[model samples]
Target: MAIPAQAPPAEEVVADPVPPPDRRRSILARIWGVYAIRRIVYALSVVWLVTTGTFFMIRAMPGDPVEVLAGKLSMSGLTMDVARVRAEQALAWDPNANIFVQYFEYLGNLLRGDFGMVIGLHNTSVLDHIMKYLPWTLFSVGLGVVVAILLGMGVGMIMAYYRNGLFDHIMSAVASTLSAIPNYLGAMALILIGSTWLGLFDFWDMRGRISIGVEPGFTGEFIGDALYHAILPLITYAFTITGGWMLVMKASTTEVLGEDYVTVARARGLKGRRIGMSYVGRNSILPLIPQVALAIGTLVGGAVIVEKILFYPGIGELLIGSITTRDYPVIQGVVLILTCAVIFTNLLVDLLNSWIDPRIRKEGAST
Candidate 1:
């Protein structure tokens, strides 16, 4: 009724203050925030411990490399004293020096990637030897792992979806059986079945990277021969390795399949295929990524026994040669590389796991 309802009480409109824009963290600080620095420190410590331990352990073995080299030279008709002196000089190391001093000297050279001359390779640089053979392992074993992992993910997804059905049962049995067997056993089996001169198929050569006369280059013909040579060992690795991946994936997928979100996806009218792939498959496969990274790193060492059986010119074979001849520098160099792989892989896995899994990131933040 009142003509002018008493003007609404003068409104006091206080503006809320704007939050200050977040200050950007420095690069190093950002890295530390992500726990990268912590992981790196831990990795470096592990590497140091392993390096020192290996140096001492190898040195502790009775009868030094000099003595072993001398003995070998003696067999080749060199007199004992001459062989001993020659070995000492070729090793370029003083047996009389303190071990701690020698260790520091070795570490220094390692930092420069100078492994010294390899007595096993008749005065070749140990670093040079690694450079030569590392690529072979990288090509064969490394590529095989990639192939196996892809196949594993596919098979695992299918197996999980079929859970307990005919396909799943068959795969589960096969996977369990293969996982229990050592990889080298697969190599041996391939030898028994595929080695042209010795195996059932006798379809391919058991030794050499390419045919004897093929010129070593990027030529198509040479590539074909090398691929032919790699086929059997590659198959052996893939067949045996995929089992573990399949088992892991199946388990992870099964667990994810029962998650509330997965159920929600289905209830929202999503196709079963859509639910499996977009919901369960994506979530389940997250764990495998770290494992795959570790596996790739480990392959740097090459499957030792398998490589031995295959007679593949890989790091494993190089390691064996170094040990047999007591090539101290070469042995240490290979061990150092392997140790780095292990530590680095662990660090990478941790970092990736924390990045990808919110729960892991939360835990890391809390710590």
Candidate 2:
């Protein structure tokens, strides 16, 4: 009993231990892991494949591009000798060089954005023409796509919320009917009604950016005129494409709404708006990311039917004219540009999907 006072029960002392160097090394190893390097390499490989494959495919197409240009020039009353000289100079087509050498030169020119002259259009560089018309196509079709997506998502969400109620049934029927109709067919019908019946838009004598009475420059007047001409085509695209989005989104939303988490959210007595925004919208909208990306590509490339029908000075018309004239330079440029656009769009959607669904990213990392 007397000795117990001396030891004070031999209390244990705890130390604040520091992490080992091996643990720190492990964290650093993970931070700069193989998965990150692999992703970067994968992306670069895709870019290389697209660029090289595009070049080869264009080269493999039938008919000499130089000869095509010369033929087009001759049609415009240029002498054969002069046309051949100009074509050779423009394309650098040496009679002495082999096919591989010619392909390499063409690839170099393409990479430099020198697409040569548009065969049918004198004094117009193919690259310049594409850049000039691309904005109009992008602006008009892009607006239409946005409108379609917004309206589609709203109506689809409402229909899904009601399940098999009257709202759902009505939307399903309308969407089905519209989706069954082709976009071009719908465009033609709208054009007939718009021009013949309602007389809202002018059918003929709608040439250039503005009315002939107004002078053309890069002025607000010209832009306003261009936009005035664009409205019908834009509306046509939206009307034709909306049905597809509505049906797809409606089906997706209904599926998402049936998930267990949605039921749990409901049972928890969460506000309807809160539950919808956080759970329903989040899950249902994942598929829309790819659709939106594809729409972006289509928008930028121009609507072939809508632009052709409306006679809009956009890429679709440019492509059409090139095809008719066998303008190889323009055709190759457009195809390459569009192919790159589509690939990039898909890549962007893939990245977005990984962001939205962490499971995808995790799976990728593991691989």
Candidate 3:
């Protein structure tokens, strides 16, 4: 304290405080930082445009919607004159309302998630109908796709690792053949071979989510019946889906095998299995991740066709009914759901990738 009595001079040449250097961020990093918000905005915009376009397109169609509704009635043997059908349509929504006004109202309802009552089903809530069938779709098609992906990816990796070997060649040929066949064609073959000609799974019910009289529940009878009914449709989606995934995975893995890190791993005296798992397999899978995520939506689209053939009680089946009846509300609701599912899934995949990539994460953290 005594030594400090000589105070430090304050009059020494003062220099201006230097600011930290501005670090440059890469384009990818910038994209990552704003990715979530950007994706959401883009998705919403796409939805809006599509919904608006669909609404207008429906309005612009040559036939009157009321007459279309009446046609459905006629099919049911409940004959209705054009006048009465027009009256009914008027009650459905404001038929007389300005198109723009109707659009705004429609938009408002959509924002509130107010999918109106089903016209064809006579006041059956659209939401209730969707909820009823969506589970079946998820259970059957969703599960089938996931199984395909896992099995396909595994088979593909093995094929890639042992490229040109007997097992690989055999699998490749089988995969190519399966992939070349159309999904519906495969379904037909399965139907004909398994059901019509072979009679292998004759005890397995060919159509519907469950037996006609079986009450749905956790009971063994209901579950067993439901599973039995689901098998045919499950086979159609899973095995057909597997071929495409195998081809993709084989290509991706093959590409990754030639990369520098893989060579280094080999040089470091790593076991073949270890190198494959840690280096090649891990990277080879990255390309497939996006496709797998997108498959959720595509699987639903595929189910629409597959379920029609299988007669599964899924939303695809419901969609077919609504389309035939020209139930505008139901049609709109389903389309909206599909669009949302796809776009949102895309957004999720994009954000997830950013989070998964360490480089992106580090850059984002810096920002």
TM-score of each: 0.81, 0.71, 0.77
What value of lDDT does candidate 1 attain over all alpha carbons? 0.79
Instruction: Report the number of the highest-TM-score candidate.
Output: 1
Instruction: Kindly indicate the candidate among 1 and 2 with the higher lDDT.
Output: 1
TM-score of 2: 0.71
Q: How would you encode candidate 2's per-residue C-alpha lDDT over 191-272 as one tens digit per residue?
A: 7998889987776755344576667678998878776777766777788778888888889999999999999999999999
In model 3, the worst 10-residue window by lDDT is: 19-28
> Clashes in model 1: which pairs?
196-202
Candidate 1 lDDT by residue in tens digits, 145-182: 88888888889888988898999999999888877777
lDDT value for candidate 3? 0.78
- Which regions of candidate 1 fall more than 4 Å away from where they truly are? 1-34, 72-77, 120-123, 193-199, 259-283, 364-367
**Worst window of 10 by summed lDDT in candidate 2:** 32-41
Q: RMSD per prediction, one decimal?
A: 10.2, 9.7, 7.9
**Per-residue alpha-carbon lDDT of model 3 for 1-367, expressed as tens digits?**
3655677778878775853344234554466457566667788899888788878876776665577766666776675785456547645687778999988998898789888777756667788889898888878877778888889999999999899999999999989887787667777888888888988876346588888889989999998888788887778878787888898899999999989989898888999989988888888887568666677776675667777777787888888877766667787888778777778777777777777775765564565
In model 3, what are the clashing residue pairs, if there are any? none
Count steric clashes of candidate 1: 1
In candidate 3, position 34 carries an lDDT of: 74
